[model samples]
Target: MAHRKWIVWIRRAILLVLLGALVYHSTIVIQIIRFRTINPRMTALMRQRAREARARGQVPKRLQVWLPYERFSPHLVRAVLAGEDPRFFVHHGFDWDQIREAIQENLEEGEIVRGASTITQQLAKNLFLSTSRNPVRKLHEAVITVELEMLLGKRRILELYLNVIEWGDGIYGAEAAARHYFGRSAAQLTPEQAAFLAAIIPNPRETYNPARHPARVERRRRIIQRRMRHVLIPAPFRAASAKAAESAFAP
Candidate 1:
């Protein structure tokens, strides 16, 4: 009788856990749907940084001004795509080729080093998940990535990503980044200036001031510029309203 009771309790516990997971995932799906049209006020990373600043008794001044996809310069978009994910429009939520390459490299090096996260995965992590680099966090990130891609589509995904990605301490979005870095608007970002911004994305917080690391930033900027030449911005992400602006400022 005791053995049967123990088995019954174990089953009940498993069912409860499964139910919790279902509810949690359902919530995430709902949030993704809502975010399709509504811009998020703050993301997980933004909130985390705010908490850290509060703990240190420093006031966090988040500088983010939402600009529609068409208002941003095409140069900035191309530069970011070139530097971060050259295959952003080609893959689903995950880049299988990059993952395979990363796995092979890690095995050969005997350590996990290379990252194969697509822009979708990064957006999912930034929006809903913490910055923890554990297996569980990665699993959550993957699940969230699927939800985002399914609900938001590529255009919305890229729009949200460009608007939320951090460019410096408390500086968020392309507009804020452009102004802070070059005293210009996102729509006015030149190719070289945009490339510099793209280059600092990997180490945004530490290398916010490109002048501090001119050689490294310049080298990465040149690489992005070269890649941008070959990259074609898809119709979905192309700014319909920026043609006149581009022509007016054409060099």
Candidate 2:
């Protein structure tokens, strides 16, 4: 009788959990629909960081400017794709090859030494999730990424990512990063400048200023620049490349 009672309770708990998950996911789907056209003013990650800063008795100010996709330099776009997600244009959301490799490396190292987050996955995490490394959080990120890819086109996804990703302690977006680092607009960034920005993205908080770690940043920047020459920019962004080139020459 006790065994049957325990089994009943377990079934009840599972149903409740499934119901909760369904409700939560429905809300996320609604939000994704809204974001298809509207630019987000702030993201969950940014708000979480702000709350932590306030708890520590420090004020956090985010420096960000929203620029249309055409306003950004082509070199910056290509360099970022080269450094972070070479398969961004090709993959649906996840990179299976990278995922398999990362899984093997993590098993051997007994810890996560590598990540296989595609640009879409990274954007999903930045927009809607916390920085917690847990199975639940990763699942949520994956779900949101699929929703983003389905609701918005590739160009919009890349634009949202560039405008919301952290570039420094307080700097957000390509425009802010360009002005903060190179004293130029995102449209005006040189190939070298763009490559340097892309190199520090993986550790933006620590390597915010490329000048501070010239050797490390330079090495990564060179690698990205070399890759940029051959890496394919998605077709949607190709038209902007000519505009980006013109802006690079602007006085």
Give the TM-score of each candidate. 0.85, 0.88
* Candidate 2 Cα deviation (angstroms), residue 222: 1.3
- In lDDT terms, how accurate is model 1? 0.82
Question: Model 2 over residues 98-194: C-alpha lDDT tens digits?
Answer: 7887678658855333457889999998999988999999998988999988988888899999999988887889999999988989988788998
Top candidate (TM-score): 2
Local accuracy of candidate 1 as per-residue lDDT tens digits, 96-135: 8877876786588553333468889999988988878999
Candidate 1: misplaced stretches above 4 Å?
A: 1-13, 100-115, 207-212, 241-251
Please, what is the whole-model Cα lDDT of each candidate in the order they appear? 0.82, 0.82
- Lowest lDDT block of 10, candidate 1: 241-250
In Å, residue 153's CA in model 2 sits off its true spot by 0.7
Residue 158 displacement in candidate 1 (angstroms): 0.7
RMSD for all candidates, in order, please.
4.0, 4.2
Candidate 1 backbone overlaps, count: 0
Q: Which ten residues in a row have the lowest lDDT in candidate 2?
A: 242-251
